[model samples]
Target: MALMITDECINCDVCEPECPNDAISMGAEIYVIDPGKCTECVGHFDEPQCIQVCPVECIPKNPEHLESPEQLMQKYHALVTAKNDA
Candidate 1:
C-alpha cells in the first residue's frame, strides 16, 4: 500500500529524502506523498523509508490507494523501467 503524510507532519523535511521512490515532495503546508509513485519501498527496502525517518510518525497507509504486495512490486518494476528508459 502507498503511504500518506498527515496534517500532523511537522514539516521536518526528513521524510522527503528518505523516500526511495521520490514520491514525497513539499506541499503547500507539509510533505505530501504521491500515491502513484509510492510503493511502500517494496523494491528498495523491507519497511517504508519515509516512516522510518519521520520524527512525528505522520506517515500512514493511504486508504484511497491501497494495493497488495504483488501490485506494489509491479509498480516498482514499472518505475524502475521508466527511470531506465529516461
Candidate 2:
C-alpha cells in the first residue's frame, strides 16, 4: 500500500528526501504521496523511507489506496520497465 501524509504534516520536508521513488512532493501546505508512483518502497527498501524520516508520524498507510505486497511489487516492476523503456 502507498503511504499518505496527513494534515498533521508539519512540512518538515524530512520525508521528501527519503522517498526512494521520488513519490513524495510538497503540496500547498503539506506533503503528498503520488499513488501512481508509490510502491511502499518495495522496489528500493525494506520499509517506507518517508515513514522512517517523518518526525511527526504524519505519514501512514493510505486506507483509500491499499494494495497487497504482490501488487506493490507488480507496480514496482512496471515502473522499472517503463523507465528502462524510456
Candidate 3:
C-alpha cells in the first residue's frame, strides 16, 4: 500500500529524503505523499523508510491506494524502468 502523510505532520523534513520512490514532497502546508509514486519501499526496504524516520508518526497506509505486496513490487519495477529510460 502507498503511504500518506497525515495533517499531524510537523514538517520535520525527515520523511521526504527517506522516500526511496521520491513520493513525498512539500505541500502547501505540510508534506504530501504522491500515491502513484509510492510503493511503500517494497523494492528498496522491508519496511517504509519514511515511516521509520518520521518523528510525528504521521505516515500511514493510504486506504484509497491499497495494493498487495506483489503489486507494489510490480510498481517498483515500473518505476525503476521508467527512471532508467529517462
Candidate 4:
C-alpha cells in the first residue's frame, strides 16, 4: 500500500529526503505524501525509508490508496523508467 503522512507530522522535513521516489513534500499545512508517486520504497529498500526516519511516526499505510506489493513494484518500475527517460 502507498503510505500517507498524517496530521501528526511535525514538519521536521526529515521524511521528504528519505523518500526515494520524491513522493513526499510540504503541503499547505504539513508534509504530504503523493500516492501516485509513492511506491513505499519498494524499488529502493526492503522497507519504507520515510517511515523508518520519521521521528513523529506520522507516516502510515494509506487505506484510501490500498495496493499490494506487486502493484507497488510495478509502480516502482514505471517510476524508474520515467526517470531514466527524462
Candidate 5:
C-alpha cells in the first residue's frame, strides 16, 4: 500500500528524496504521497526507504488506497513494462 503522511509530520523535508518512485512531495503543511506513483518500494528496494528515513515516523499505510504485496508488484510491473516496451 502507498504510504500516507500524517499531520504529525514536521515538514522536515527528509523523506522526499528517498522515494525511488518520487511519490513524496512537499505539501503546504506536510509531505504528501502520490498513491498512483507509490509502489511502496516493491520493485526498487527491500524496504520502504521513505519510512526508514523519516525521523518523525509519520508515514503510515494509506488506508484509503490499501493494496497488497501482489498488487504492488503488478503496479510496479505496469509502470515499467510499458516504458520498456516503448
Candidate 6:
C-alpha cells in the first residue's frame, strides 16, 4: 500500500528528502504523499525511508490507495522506466 502523512506531521522537513520517488511534498498544511508516485520504496529500499526518518511517526498506509506487494513492485518498475526515459 502507499503511505500517507497524517495531520500529526510536525513539518520537520525530514520526510521530503527521504522519499526516493519524490512522492512526498509540502501541502497546504502538512506533507502529502502522491499515491501515483509512491511504491513504498520497494524498488529502492527494504523499508520506506520517509517513515524511517519521520520523527512523529505520522506516516501510515493509505487505505484508499492500497496495493499488494507485487503491485507495488510493478509501480516501482514503471516509475523507474519513466524516470529513465526522461
Highest-scoring model, lDDT: 6
**Which digits, one per residue and each the tens of the lDDT, describe model 3 over residues 33-60?**
9999999999999989998998889998
lDDT of each: 0.93, 0.89, 0.93, 0.93, 0.89, 0.96
- Give one clash count per candidate, in the order shown: 0, 0, 0, 0, 0, 0
TM-scores, one per candidate: 0.98, 0.93, 0.97, 0.97, 0.89, 0.98
Q: Give the local distance difference test score of model 6.
A: 0.96
Score candidate 6 by TM-score against the native: 0.98
- Per-residue alpha-carbon lDDT of candidate 5 for residues 30-68, written as tens digits (9 for 90 to 100): 889999989999999999998999888998899899899
Model 2 RMSD in angstroms:
0.9
Clashing pairs in 4: none
Model 4 agreement with the true structure over 1-86: per-residue lDDT tens digits: 89999999889988899889999999999999999999999979999999899998999899999899999999999999999999
Query: Could you tell which candidate, 5 or 6, scores higher by TM-score?
Result: 6
* Residue 15, candidate 5: C-alpha displacement in angstroms: 0.6
For candidate 1, write residues 15-84 as lDDT tens digits: 8888888999999998899999999999899999888888888888999998999999999999999999
Residues 2-84, model 6: lDDT tens digits: 99999999999999998999999999999999999999999899999998998899999999998999999999999999999
TM-score of 2: 0.93
Ranked by TM-score, top first: 6, 1, 3, 4, 2, 5
Which runs in model 1 stand beyond 4 Å of their true positions?
Answer: none
